[model samples]
Target: MACSGCYSVNFMAVSSNPNKPLTSSTLLTSKLSSSYSQIPFSSLNFNSKLSRIQLHKSNTAPNSFVVVSGIKAEPLKVMISGAPASGKGTQCELITKKYDLVHIAAGDLLRAEVAAGTENGRRAKECMEKGQLVPDEIVVTMVKERLSQPDSQEKGWLLDGYPRSSSQATALKGFGFEPHIFILLDVPEEILVERVVGRRLDPVTGKIYHLKYSPPETEEIAARLTQRFDDTEEKVKLRLLTHNKNVEAVLSMYEDVTVRVDGSLSKEDVYTKIDTVLRNVLGQRQAAIVLLVFPCDMFGISTA
Candidate 1:
């Protein structure tokens, strides 16, 4: 590992040839010691930061794990857009986990503000109660407040369902939140309608289900399912139409960094394409493997 103060370990896997990778043959060539006072796994901490440590506990090798370290990546800013039923939630969950990012769905943030009853929330409530759309300034303020938080500053953020118009898109850039990439999940309007119509939500568990694609696991859950008032086919169609009409404005601003993904594919396939694009944006990471050892072995010098 490149980290300083890491020399306390008793048995560092000092590679004979740093350029050549260690193979099973190399392990077999040496007479392995059966009793070295094996280290526990929980005590090792490699100071090097690489995608939130991405720790993987190995079952095959009880006392060992491969440590991956590299130049820490920049705070990633990913902006994604899709129709209401385009599986944004599922993809956001995956992307945020894989990249170690904060998920900032603008709608969620606005709702949270409203729930907290802050000054912004109060104004938003007035507009909402009066059946008027919340002003762009209110939405932008909520988004900016969220982006300025410590978590967002350190972990970066996945901006979802934001920048609905050219003014909003420009406003984000003005606030120094220019996105690294703009991803559009393109699903047909007909499929969007189909997905919305079949969708049901379990209000108690807050779990969503689709009648055709992914149904309730049990009859009890099915009986408890409720569909959102906005999930009706008419509203879904209008949402899709608005998304299509205004997406060009956002795309035009970020044309150089824009990537459109096929939302019709299986979730796994869709994520594969997204992962590839995000990796490209992240670029090459200078990495090395350090043998993970517990505190008893890794922290103290062996007198023997």
Candidate 2:
């Protein structure tokens, strides 16, 4: 199904059990060699080929979105999937800075709307005050609008929320929005609860800090920092339960391409792992495209 809104030709995984190291096939190696053969073997080109081959042989490999020659690179659209308070916001902040990608946090958007007195915000705020989930249609419409923005066309985007169900995922697909990567942050329930309880927000700036990891200096000052009423232990548990259930269903739709990162690790460590995975995935896609374009010529096989 085509998206009913304006059509923009905006160009845009995983594993598990014991997490075995990914191995690329020898076929890819042979194809890569052939791909190089098709190009003029000047000294510069030779060195380039050697570097490319070595890069491809590293532990990293591409996930999807092969980069083809002469094809403009599309902005990467990524979905960060995890339970509430799973450090997703932290990771996104880092990623957007490093990669120049747009960050769209659905909760923030809805909150802003409520602050701005928008109709949708009014409706969503009412539901939130009552502890109800906002309707999926309202959420999806907001997402569509966000994605259609001018900045979204230029900079790649990280979607922080707003696909809480299988139906929303299906709707996104119909809208021609397929994420190149779906990252899941796996953290233990006990740790999550502790983190949630320790969290404090600066109501003036909305900056979040944790008493343990990122305390506000003095106890007097930190004590003044407000803890969200919603962040209470009982509420955190309930939210986590609901998040886990919904995430499980949403993840079922993306079994093959999902990459799970250990949120238990230090924030820097987690970011490093994710960055490595993304680079590998991007490189693999590039290699595939190069091989595809010069298949016969690269391998010394006559297709004519």
Candidate 3:
């Protein structure tokens, strides 16, 4: 069904299960090597052969949007998925620093709205205070407005902790900002629980530390450490269960574009695997299309 209001929405899903053969249309749409040969770029004097491409950056990070052969690269729209304490926050920070992409956490955006006392935020707060999930329309609307920001439109953005359900994913596509890639961090439940329950936050510097793996530097620092109320084991377990239920369905929707990483490895090792997947994706670069979809406040909700 099409979304109400000014937005028009269409969604496409790709199958990436290696054991099963893809259908005719799925094969055609897949970004695999076989499909690239079928692109009609050859008639335009463009190379059909995939080549290794390096990302170049200017002095300023935002100014470093990818440019290849005079064609500006499409903004990198990525969504990172993981269970609680799966190290998504750490990885996102690393990715943003390395690639200069805007990082938008769904929770943060919602929190900011509530803090600013917007109408949507008020509605969201009611549900949140009751420990209920926020409605998809509210979340999707806020996300649409966020992506319409100048920095997000130009430099590209990485989304974290949004679209946990298939419906939420569809709603995002309805907003015309479907992610180009999906990164899933697969960690054992045991490990995830341990990571979450053992986590500590520095009240002063705001740095995260694990009680066992990455404790404070000294006893003095440890004394100053504080754990969030939600860091308890019961909370972690409930959060994980909620995450598992929603993420399984969402992952299926992006099978072709999904990069599953084993999150049990060391932080650096996990990052290495993620970096490799990103490099491979960027290597098979598509012809660029710079879309200022929401420029000039052309798309969003009606205040009235």
Candidate 4:
């Protein structure tokens, strides 16, 4: 799983206050507190405790970030699972911005291949035309290809809407591509079905909007918006049922690392919860590697 794009930060000690930037002297002299006991670091282990998260924001809006001590032996890898209309896309965008991760939507990749008329696309298209689920191997192949790209290998990835079944999850692990963290968004069935009713997709950008909550801003955008054939309440119900069944199997494989959040919450709230989880995961110690997080002043020291 090693790649040219991987980045590793090595630190001998950590500063508990992210706002107070760590100095070379601090690195050589800081002591580990009883609460933040020194935990052995490893490349892929998430068992180590997160050192600290300090946030700073302006009065009008929160534009600050949390910094902590952590290490990543490999690029960040994340997976998302949720019922239809559970705000997965929105959260993915936030996570990408916060973590600088590649947003690898499996459905989007398949759609692109089909649109390009590639062999895999043709095969998948034929299967879909017959109302059959596209085979897992085809989907997995496309995913592997996408992940192998330089951007994904370097920046890491946020995998959306793949590995629906236990076998598919196993295939991912078989390739040594198991996610560092598996996120599950929990929403009420009623809310999910209701959201589906107003859903709209822009074929050009692949961005979705809700007619009531977030309509297209311009007339041109609205005119080009299209609804999926399966957006109906009945369809939503069926999809939800099927997804729950698959997720049960999938979750079993990721129980130790899975973090579930309430998708019914407001967008900001949901993102905040997810952000906290990822920060904690990233802060985990490994191989005596201390990831020093500095409170981003937006114009301050660039971690990038």
Tell me the tens digit of each residue's lDDT in model 4 across 1-304. 1212212234322333322333333332212221121212221123233443333221222233333454336777999989878989889999998899999988678777788999998887775444345688899888888888999988899999777788888888888788889999999998998898899999889889899989998999999999875687776776777788788999999999899999999999999999998888777723446554333433242323
Instruction: For each candidate in the order shown, give its overall lDDT on alpha carbons.
Output: 0.69, 0.66, 0.67, 0.71
Local accuracy of candidate 1 as per-residue lDDT tens digits, 6-96: 2322232321211123433323121113322222323333342323423232333324332332233458889998887788878898999
Is 2 or 4 the stronger prediction by TM-score?
2
C-alpha TM-score for every candidate? 0.65, 0.70, 0.65, 0.69
Task: Rank candidates, lDDT, best first.
Answer: 4, 1, 3, 2
Cα lDDT tens digits for candidate 3, 199-304: 9988788788998998899999999998865677887777777787788889888887998899889989999988887777676665242111111122222323
Q: What is the C-alpha RMSD of each candidate to the true structure, in Å?
A: 10.7, 12.7, 16.7, 13.4
| Candidate with the greatest TM-score versus the true structure | 2
Candidate 2 displacement at residue 270 in angstroms: 1.1
lDDT per residue as tens, model 2, 101-135: 88989888888888799888888877665555677
Model 1 ranges with Cα > 4 A deviation:
1-73, 113-133, 284-304
Which run of 10 residues does model 3 get worst, by summed lDDT? 11-20
Whole-model alpha-carbon lDDT for candidate 3: 0.67
Question: How does residue 182 of candidate 2 score in lDDT?
Answer: 90
Between the candidate structures 2 and 3, which one is better when assessed by lDDT? Answer: 3
Tell me how far the alpha carbon of residue 75 in candidate 1 is from the true structure, in angstroms, after superposition: 1.0
